[model samples]
Target: MRTSGVLPDAFTCSFLLKACVSLLDIANGKILHGVVEKLGFGSNLFLQNMILNLYGLCGEMADAMLLFDKMPQRDVVTWNTVITQMLKRGDIEGASRLFSRLEEESGLRPNQVTVVSVLAACADLCALDLGKRVHEYSNRSGFKNNVLVCNTLIDMYAKCGSLEEASRVFDEMEGKRTVFSWSAMIVGLAAHGRAQEALSLFSSMLQDGTEPNGVTFVGLLHACAHMGLVDEGRAFFTSMTRDYGITPGIEHYGCMVDLLSRAGLVKEAYEFIMEMPIKPNGIIWGALLGGCRLHKDIKLAEQAIQHLSVLDPLNDGYYIVLSNIYAEAGRWEDVTRVRKLMKARGVKKTSGWSKITLDDGIVHEFVAGDESHPQAEGIFRKWDELVVEMMLRGYVANTSLVLLDIEEEQKVKFIYRHSEKLAVSFGLLNTPAGTTIRIIKNLRVCEDCHSALKLIAAISGREIVVRDRNRFHCFKDGCCSCGDYW
Candidate 1:
């Protein structure tokens, strides 16, 4: 068009910029911005909003904000665009603040899009109070049955530690349940250690004449894996292929491997992977590796690591786990080799972080060996006291999980002060008696912490639910929900 001397107007420039955003073509989007300026569409309000949205999608928040602030007239799109950008960047607090301004201070009514974004932010932060308020507002504002808004509410309530509320919204959604609706509720139930309920829900979905899709099977298989429902999961996998004609995708295969391996059927899990029609991906191998870790099967773990390293060579945790497997067996030479490989790959094992939601709506964060919190001194002091109590109650430290090749005493100390332990200790200190302590961890909870949590729950009479990298572990009365299998 430019070569034919047909210069683009504001409408044309905005259309192409939106295309660039959809295609994620930032390079050409900048070129289009230049064209918009040359055509003197720079000051055009509609074109300016498009430019702002382009920058937002590209994650150039500074530029997006500069353009946004300078605009003499702004509309709902401008606020929503910036708020969505904040969410994409994982700045949930920023998004919530902007969302408030969009509704209250800016005197603009939030549409369904804004509500969805806010609910998403609430979920990520595990801000249950705010999420409850958002749910109330959404219902009163007549978005209760809006599929996206309702689906997001399910996810928010689930992640914020309320599976019952999520289910309530699902039931009340009535005729508005979409595939996403089923997926959200199913996945939420699976993640929260309600595997049997999740599968029952799947049965209902099928009975309602809804076709099972890949996502649906992923949830079914995952629920089975969490509960060691091997036979059930196997049947679902077969049915997914034979009845629904949905060929087992990588994720579906991952769920199967996880299901089989978690049930101590390591040999069969390996065989299943070998017989896969498609080349197994990293996720598939990772599931098997996790199983190997639980069962302490070094041989199969080595096989999984070989394939996994090639696929995710830069993933430090896999190498660390391999080193750990060797370290557990006193295979010093092999452990040394794994460490050397990590150094060569420039892979550093990132420290784990644990987030605990307090009753007052504040989310507290803890990192391994982190001492930056204002209450760090008291938290650590309380941690030491708990350690003493647990030791007195015969809680032996499972120091095999401590990767460092250090003294025995040092290893035990390391396990005792893991971020999750500190988070749990802090929870006990701050919360009232009988209050359930829910903690979220960024990495897999180590075996030592798992054992300690069981004992801690027994001693303190507190029910603890920990959401780790793998799955939920509910500890009560000196036992874990996984029955020491996980």
Candidate 2:
């Protein structure tokens, strides 16, 4: 068309914009944006929406916002496009602000798509109050029965830790719930530790003629794993392929590995990985390594490390886990060799960190040597007191897991510097009395930290729930919900 001395029209530009989005060619999209401007079609509603969507897809939030702001007329699709883009970029505040301004400033009423997008943003940010407000608006606008809206509401409520509200939304939907709807509810239940409810809901979903999908099975399996229902997990794993015709994917395999590993079936879990039709990825092997750590199976842990190292050569977590395994098994030589190999390969250990949401809804994060908080000194002092109490309760400092050749006293100090401890101390200092402290760790919680949390929960009389990469550990009343298995 350029050779013919004619520029592409709006429709042609829209098609090219989609191609650029699919290919993630932001530069080409910019070139098309110029073409659209030069052709005097920038104001065309459809073309503008397409450009907005393309920028959003490419994660160019700034450009998408500029386009959205310049649009002469805004519709529901335009609003949804921009809001979804903001949510995708993790700009929850900006998305919420825009959502609030849409009706009053732009006279644009949010439709189901807009509501779903906003609800998803709420879910990602765990904005419970905003999610509840959106739910009320959805009801007032008579979109309560819209399946997509209701499903998103369920997901939002679940993610915001409002499982009851999620269930209410699930029950109130008028039509037969779809697989996604059921899956959302199941995921909610699983996340909230309502394992039996999740299983019952899965059975009900099956009975309602909604065939279970991979996600549904994953949720069900996770529920079973959390509840220690090993036989039920096995049956579900078998029924997934045999009865439902759903080939087990890597996620399914990972869930199965978690189930078997958590059930003290370390050897069986290792064999299951070998029997997988697809090559086991880092997640599956990592699950097995975790199991080995739990069961103290040094041999299987070593085998898992070998496979995982080859599968993810650049991943530092594998080395960390393997070194910890050797340390746990008192194989000092192997630990030393692993350390040397890591040093030779220039692989540094990734620092573990955890986050806790305070009463004001602000998430405070901490890592080793985190001195950024205003109350760091006080928090550390409190941590020292808790460590003393823990020691008196027969808590031995486990220096082996640090994978370092430091002195025992230094190892104890290092344990105090762990991210979870820092986060827990921060929670103690900042939160009111008896407030439950929920911490999320990026990696597995080390044995030292886990024991410390148990002590903290007991001494402080605070419920401490730590969600690590693998599973949830609820520490309360001097014990962990995981039975020290994790």
Candidate 3:
């Protein structure tokens, strides 16, 4: 059109920019941005908002900010564009700073879109104070009755570790709670170990005529798994389709595998996987493999390895899990062979790590070979102290769970390298005396690490909550809240 001497208007330019965003053509998007500037439509609020949106969609925060800064007269949409963009890019700090600046300098009041975006940032950062402030802002701005804003507030509070506040927001919602609202509460309750409440809320969701979607079922399944309600889990698994006409997806199947496996029904879990309507994915096989490790079912563990290797040939966790299974079975030769295969395939196991929030509200993370922190030496020394204290509290590290072909001493070294232990040790050093340590891991917490954590919790007189890939384990006084079933 430009070449034909028919210059595009602001609306035309905005449409083209949206098209570029949809196609994810950042190069073409920049070209369009230049065209908008040349056409003198760059200052148009609508066109500028489109540019902001395009930059955000492309994850080009710097470009978006530059555009935002150049805009002379900004509207709520303009601020929402930049704030939402920052949130999506995981720049919570940038989003918060901009929000503060908008209120202080721009004098532009935030709308529902702005509130949603800011709430999302708060949730991602786990910034409880910021979230509460947003909550107050929403209330003062009369957005407290907005269902979308209320739902987001519920989610923000829940994710930030304030279930009571989440419940309060949930209860005060005058509007009909949507499925998402129910999901947020269910997830929050399940995550915080309020499994029964989660399940009850799920039932209430259905009774209130809100049809439970796949996510709702997933949350219910998770609650059932946490409570060891295998019968309820299985019933829900079937009811998902039979009663609700919702087909069971990979997530549903994954939850079922977790539920059965955690109940020590390893063989049944394996059989269920074989019978899945869809071919079992890596997550399903991984769950069964995890169950095999927990129950020490070497024969089934070997069977699980065959499925896992074929399903996820490139994932190193399968190889590591299989090797461990062989080690647990006392098959050193098999372990050696598995190691050789891993070497030949160039499969490197993923390093495990954990994160903990200190008393000062700073999150410290640790992984194997982590040396970037300023107090690395002090952290290691604290680790040593915890090791001694743990042993004094009758904590015997379960080296047998290492599933290595190495001697006992080597196995002990491997256990110490676990991500949970590193995070716990760091927590001990950074937190105040008697402060509970909450660590979240991306993988399953090894049995040895679990036992050691219990001992550490007792010796230090601090509660410890560890959220692994599968479930939550709350440790206090040398015992886990899960009753060792997980």
Candidate 4:
């Protein structure tokens, strides 16, 4: 049209922008944006929003924010577009700050979309206090009864270590429950090690005439894995095809391998992987390797690592695990070789860290042996006190898997200063005696830390909830909710 000297109108630009968004053609979209400006169509709000949508969908947040700041007039769609894109790029904190700006600056009440997205961010960060504030706002704005918002509320509460609140939300959505609602609740319960409750709820879901989907079964399999119910896991896996006609996806298959592996069925899990109709992925082999680690089957671990090196060569955890397995068997030569290979491939092991959210809604993070916080002095002092009490209560440090050639005393000190312990120590020092301490860890909790936390919870007269990479461990009265399975 430009070459023919026939000027394109706003509607033509709008349709072409929509096509660009659909095709994800950002280069053409940029040229069209310049053409729109050159044609004096840039001031059109509809056209501007379309261009913003184009930038956001194509993962060009820099351009989106630039345009967003320049627009003199905006709408809720503009804010939601930017917020959603921020989340897609894994900027949970940024999305949250934008939501706050939306409220403080725009004078625009958040709609259901904004509420749901913000609630998801709250869940990811385990920001329970902020989530509660949002829940209160949702109630005042009459969004509490919206099914999607309610579903997200359930998920947020569960992930934030408030199962009672999650259950309350689930019950409140009684007549309005959908498959997603049921699945979210079941998955939440399973994650918290409430396997019996999850299974019972599934039966009730069936009685209520809700058909189970793949997600629902995934929850069931996870519940079984936590409880070490291998037979029940097999039954559920078979029923997915026989009764529900739901073909298993990679997630379902992964859950099955995890279930069998955690139950000490490493050999059976390996056979199951080989017989799979679909090709096994890294998660499948990783599950088998984790099982081998648990059961101390070095031969099977070596076999699994061969496949893992080809499938997921850059995952530092696999190499680290293989090294640890060799260390366990007193094979220092092989451990050194694995370490050399990791160095050669530029694979660095991920350092473990733990974070806790306080009542003030700020997250405090601690790394292993971290003493950088202002309260570092008090935190270590608190740990010293807990150590005395824990040793008196029969808490022996299990340093069998330290994997270091250092002195035994050094190894003991190393495990004692694990990140989760420091985070929990901080929580105990700050909170009252009876308050529950919730912690989130970046990696799986070590055996020594897990045992120590159990005793510490009993001695401190508090409930300690630790969300690790694999699952949650609720410690109270010298016992764990996982029953020592996970």
Candidate 5:
């Protein structure tokens, strides 16, 4: 048609752009962008939105935003397209800000798609306040009964450290609940270490005539692993194949290894891996190594490391865990050797960071010894005050995991500055006395921080909820939800 000098109309360009989006053909999309502009169809809202969709779907957010900014008008689809893309790329805060703009400035109420996307961002950031506002909006808009929105609400509430709310949402869904509703609640309960409750829910799910799927088993296996119910976990694993007719995937296998490993069946877990039909991945070996670390199985840890070094060479956490294990065993020479190996391989430890969402619906982040926040001085001062109370409450910092050859006091100081500690102190200073403090961490919370938080919660008379790399730890009255098993 171009060779015959037949000019493409807005509909023709829209059809071609839709095809580009379907095929993820960004190259052709760019060429068509020029064609649309050259053909004087640039002002056509339908064709322009299609081009934006092509850019967003193809991972060209820069171009999408460029086109979006230049558009004089945008409908709900336009905002949803950009916001969903932001989510796919893990830009939770960006998506949240865009949702804010949509609410405050766009003069348009968000549609169902926009609400789901914003709820996802809220869940990821643990922005409970913003999530609650969105939930209210859903109710006002009559979207509360919508299954997809309700499912997302369950997930959001659970991750935000409000299991009570999550359960309420699940119960309300009742006849409307899908398999995902059950699975999401199960997984959330498992992550919170309410394994028995999670399993009981699965029983109810089965009784309700909901057929279990692979995801359901993953949640069940996770529950069993966390509860240290080896026999029960094994039964569930076998039942997946025998009863449910579901072929266990890598995640299932990983959960099994975690269960055996956590149960101190290191050798059995190893043998289990050797006998697997599919090849084990780094997560499989990493689970074994974590068990070794817990049980101090040095020999097995070394073997796991051998496979880990090849499978995930650049992963610094593995090297660090190995070194810590060596340090725990008082094998200074082995620790030194591991450090040397890491240096030789140019692997650096991943920096741990923590983020906390305040009532204002903004997420604030911190690193170990972070002084970047505007209230850094107040945060540090509050921590100093908490240290006095914590010490009075018998909070002696456990420096056993601190590998550095330093004085005991120096080790304690090092422990004091971990990212979670900073985030908790910030929460204490910023929130009211009785408000619960919620924190999300990028790495496992160190033992020292865990112990300190228990005492902090006791002394502050506040509940502190922490979600780390593995699971949730809710501290209240000088006790953690995991019973220190994690």
Candidate 6:
């Protein structure tokens, strides 16, 4: 319109800015901001809100906030935009505070979009209490029936370690079920080690004449992987392409490798990777490497590292995993070589951390060997007691995972300082019996922690649900839901 000698108005600029946001065209977006100012629509609330949203979506939060502060008038959309962007950037506290202000200060009732965004924040933080409150409000306000809101509710519940509630929401939404609904519910069930139930739900979805999408197959494959149903996983992967004609993406390939590798078919996984129509990406190679680490397949792990070094040269995870395999195999020299390579390349390993959700609606984070919490001394004391109790129960600390060239006794002490154990110890100290302890890990759970957790469950008689870097493991009655396979 401007090129045609017609002066663009606020509406035109808003539409253009939205297009730029959708396209993530930061370069053009800045020029459009200038155009808005030149058109003298800087004070146009709608256009200004759109500009704020554009900056937010482009990850220019500082710019967005600067503009937000200068605006003389702010509407519900403006608040929603800023809050939603905050959540998208993983700023749960910021989003939650803004969400509270929406009703308390502005007296603006949150719409489905705002509620969905808040629910997402709650999910990421694993703030189940907050999520429950949001669910209650959605039901009271009749927004639970909204498709987007309902779908997000299921995801939030699942991600917060409440799979049953997610399933209830899905089962009750019979008429409102969409493809996204089925996909979300399936992934949730599959993640919780409910492979059979997830498959049953998939069958039910098909019976209801709902066609499967790529995401649906991803869920099915995931269920198979965790269940060690290699034949079933193979059949599903075949059907996904041969029956549904949906081309398998890297995610599907990664799942297939995980299924084969986790089941101890490391050689087959490598063969499958080589046969992939598309070049195997880092995920596929990493999946293979992870399998090698699980099964101690040094040869395949070395091969995986060869490809991974070329595919993801800067990723320290692959190198660390290879070192782990070497250590497990008792090849100390190889472990040293891998560590040397990592140091030479300046590849810093990602530090492991765990998060525990407290009953008082707070999430506490503990890094490996962390002593930052106010109750750190008490937590450590509890952990020490648990260690002694576990030792009396015939638990021997598996120090093979401690890669350092140190004394065996020191390695055992090092194992005790793992973040997950610290979090669980803190949970046991504070929480009442029979309450489940949920932990989120930033890296794959070490073998030592996995064995130690199994014993912890047996001794404490409390169920522990840990969503590790790889998959979810629920330990109870001296066993894990993955049956020692994962």
TM-score of 1: 0.88
Mind giving the per-residue lDDT tens digits that candidate 6 earns over 1-486? 667898887778888888998899888988998898887888889888888888899899999989988887888789989987886675656666776777887777888876887788777766676678778878987886788988988988888778879989887899889989999999988887889989999999999999999999999999999889999999999999898999999999999999999999999999998899999999999999989988888888999999988989989999988887887778889889988899998898889999887766556889998988899999999988888988888888887678888999899878889999999999998899999898889887888899889989999999998988767788998898777767
The deviation in Å at residue 301 for candidate 2 is 3.1
Q: After best superposition, candidate 4 residue 82: deviation in angstroms?
A: 4.3
Candidate 1 residue lDDT tens string, 415-467: 76789988998999899999889888989887788888998999899998887
* Candidate closest to the true structure, highest TM-score: 5
Q: Output the lDDT of residue 124, model 1.
A: 74
**What's the lDDT for residue 338 in model 3?**
89
Tens-digit lDDT track of model 2 for 162-217: 66688888988747588999999897777656788899888788778888899998
Model 4 reaches what TM-score against the true structure? 0.89
Instruction: At residue 240, give the lDDT of candidate 3.
Output: 87
* Better-scoring candidate (lDDT), 5 or 6: 5
- Candidate 4 lDDT, tens digit per residue, 328-376? 8899999999999999998998999999977765678999999899999
**Inter-residue clash pairs, candidate 2:** none
For candidate 2, what's the RMSD? 3.5
Which stretches of candidate 1 lie above 4 Å from their native place?
A: 1-8, 15-39, 42-46, 124-127, 357-363, 428-437, 455-463, 476-479
Question: Residue-pair clashes per candidate, as listed?
Answer: 0, 0, 0, 0, 0, 0
> Can you give the TM-score per candidate against the true fold?
0.88, 0.85, 0.83, 0.89, 0.90, 0.89
Q: Give the TM-score of candidate 5.
A: 0.90
- Off by more than 4 A, model 3: 1-12, 81-90, 124-129, 174-176, 203-211, 242-245, 297-311, 332-347, 357-363, 401-414, 428-436, 459-461, 476-478
- Give the alpha carbon lDDT tens digit for every residue of 1-486 in model 5: 989988888888888888888899999999999999898887888888888888888889898989999988888988888887776665666776787798688898898888888788778877788788889988998998999999999999988889999999999998999999999999999989899999999999999999999998998998889889899899999999999899999999999999999999999999999999999999999999999999999999999999999999989999998998999999999999999999999999899999887766567889987878899898889899998988887778888878999999998888888999999998988899899999999999888898999999998999999999898999999999888888
- lDDT computed for candidate 6: 0.86
Find the 10 residues in a row with the least total lDDT in model 3.
355-364
lDDT, each prediction: 0.83, 0.82, 0.80, 0.89, 0.90, 0.86
Off by over 4 Å in 5: 1-36, 39-41, 44-47, 50-66, 85-97, 100-108
